[model samples]
Target: MKFAAFSGVFIAHSIQEAMKLTQKLGMDGIEIAAREPHLSPTTSAPRIKGIKALAADLGLEIPVLAGYMGGFSTASDQECEQAFDDFNRLLDMGGELGSSMIRVAPGGPNAFLAHDYHYAKAAHWLNKCAEAAQEYQIKLVLEIHNQSLVETVDSSLKLLHLIEHDHVGMIHDAGNMYITETDYGRDSIVNLGKHLFHVHVKDEIRVAEVGAPGTFLNLTHRGEEGFLQSRLGEGAADHQPMFDALKEVGYNGWITLECHAPYPAYERLAHDFQIVKKMLSWEHA
Candidate 1:
């Protein structure tokens, strides 16, 4: 498998600067984030063309588009239509940039009524999106995030089975699934092996109590406390086993480093990239 970097963690800088950093870090490619303060659908074609040209000039390829942030659950018909419009635009841009996969999180905080309802909604919308994506021959991979409906492996499998679309798959995020109280971490990957299209590598640690033995206080609200982000090999995530598992499954997809730690952007990303390179044994191509 190849190694890349997700630009989402580099939210502090412009996309152009992120591209430059990706090249400098000796990565094969990048996963662009198509959201505000990063990259948006409204970003002009010429600007995107400039990015493509730069990548080519630097011998880099964009294998994935990381941030298509519209969720289906809370969306009205109009909102869904707008999301569709935005998705199509992203697909067009990905085609222009020569990216084969696009990453999306199924639904955000407002999307889930309950687990089952969220799955049903996500399955329906993903199938529709998959049909739309087929026009450009792009694959839509859902990243497993906390607030997303497909947060666990079983849920992800259910959505995959329900959608039953070849273009739809999972993007396993090691850190996103790592909660202090639960073994949600490894299950997400183990359950969705063959269906995994991409991987986002990071680490997390929890220190607060949240009533349950394995449950951590929800850090988002002030009521919760004690959550920390660490570099690869520094936190709870045992990435080597994950790497070995991917190798066993013959997953030749991009393993992108997502440095969400609270360090300076450039330093953290560069360090994470090097650490991942060593773990993956990536060589110049």
Candidate 2:
């Protein structure tokens, strides 16, 4: 697997600077956030080509374009149609930027899947995205994150199976999956198996508990969402088995470092760049 950096790590930074940082750190590629200061569907086509030209000049690949839209499982048909149009624009941009994968969430905060928000909604929507991705000749990846309909492997598979498109897949996020009742990362990777298309490398350390052993707090019972920013291996999440499992599955895809801690964009991601390379056993080679 090759290393990549998520431009979200350098929030508010210019895409030119992000590209420079990625090149400086020797990351194989970058996955830019589909938002301001990075990119948006409405971003001018010339600017998109400029970004692509810069990546080529720096010898960095633009592999993924991550979108932040959500609420599919709960949004009304009108909302979904708007999102579909937004995704179409993104698909067009990804093709222009030479990105092979376009990342999106099934639904983020307030998904409320437990309250009659069925997988069918996500599946139907992703089927549409799959069609768009096919036209773009890129894969549609669902970022496994908390507060989304497909936060866990089971739920993720439920949606992927329903879509049943070759252009659709999942990107594993260990930090996001840690709080979903973790046994390290074993079960999480097991469920993903060969369905995994990309990996977001980060760590989480859970703190602040309410009940006793064998009992855990539900999402509502949790104190705050602070555990997600833990430093590499300093958090409750152990990623060894996760790496091992991916290797077992022969997952040779982009492994991007998402540094939220060890703060100040460059310093943190620079440190994490080494950490992730080691995890992939590239410490020396």
Candidate 3:
């Protein structure tokens, strides 16, 4: 698996500076967040070209352009239509940035959002995205995230199988289990199988002692975001089994670090970079 870092974690750093840091740290690639202060859909054409040039200059591949296309599944028809339009803009951005895989969410509203109709609507949106992305040669990677219609292996596959579009794929996020309490089934990687197009790696432990499900998901601060802490083997998420499952499936793809490591982003990001590199090596060895 190729090692890439998501630029979102370095929110304080400029996209160019973050790419410099990523390259200096010896990462193979980066998953550029197609958001503000990064490479939003509204980013200028020259800036997009500069980004592609920068990646090439640093020998870093931009595999995934992760975006926040949330709440489409459970939204009204108008909202879903707007979400699809937003996804098209992201796909256009991805094409300009020289990246093919763009990350999106099968967002749903409210708890108990899981339903056949929800799955079908989400699939319809994906199909629209796939149809639109064909011109850009981009693939819309649906991430396993909470409040999403296809938030688990079972739910995700149930939705994807209905689309029959190759441009629609999956991203397995192990850290997501902290939110989706029942996300892990018998064998997630085995279940994901061929359709597993990408992966996001992050380690998180419970913030509160004996925390309930979705307990750690709450923010301690305004922009606290996700993850209490992150280290490879020492964290709450068990990655070895996940990697072993990848091996079993012969899956060789981009395993990105959506870095959420604490203060001194450089230190934590650099440390986890090596940790993931070692993890991938050991897994393949």
- Give me the candidate number with maximum lDDT: 2
Q: Give TM per candidate.
A: 0.86, 0.89, 0.87
Output the number of the TM-score-best candidate. 2
Candidate 1 per-residue lDDT over residues 28-77, each given as its tens digit? 98788887665678989888888899889888889998756558766677
Which regions in candidate 3 have their CA more than 4 angstroms from the true location?
109-113, 183-186, 209-229, 281-285
Kindly provide the TM-score of model 2 when superposed on the true structure, using C-alpha atoms. 0.89
**What are the per-residue Cα lDDT tens digits for candidate 2 across 1-285?**
888899998766899999898899888999999999889878999999899999999999989999876457778899888888888999999988889998877774423334434677877888888887786789988977776776778767777888869778888888777765534376777777677888897766655653432223336225343343656766667788888888877777888888676467888778767766577687473
What overall lDDT goes with each candidate model? 0.73, 0.77, 0.74
Per-residue lDDT of 180 in model 3: 54
Q: Which ranges in model 2 have alpha carbons more than 4 Å from their true place?
A: 108-117, 209-228, 283-285
- Enumerate residue pairs that collide in model 3: none
The per-residue C-alpha lDDT of model 3 at residue 268 equals: 71
- Model 3, residue 25: C-alpha shift (Å): 1.3
For model 1, the superposed segments whose C-alpha errors exceed 4 Å read 108-113, 180-190, 209-225, 281-285
lDDT of 3 by residue, 52-154 (tens): 8989999999988898874667778888787778888778778767787988777764224467777777777778788888898888888876556655788
Model 1: which ten-residue window has the lowest total lDDT? 213-222
Better of 1 and 3 by lDDT: 3
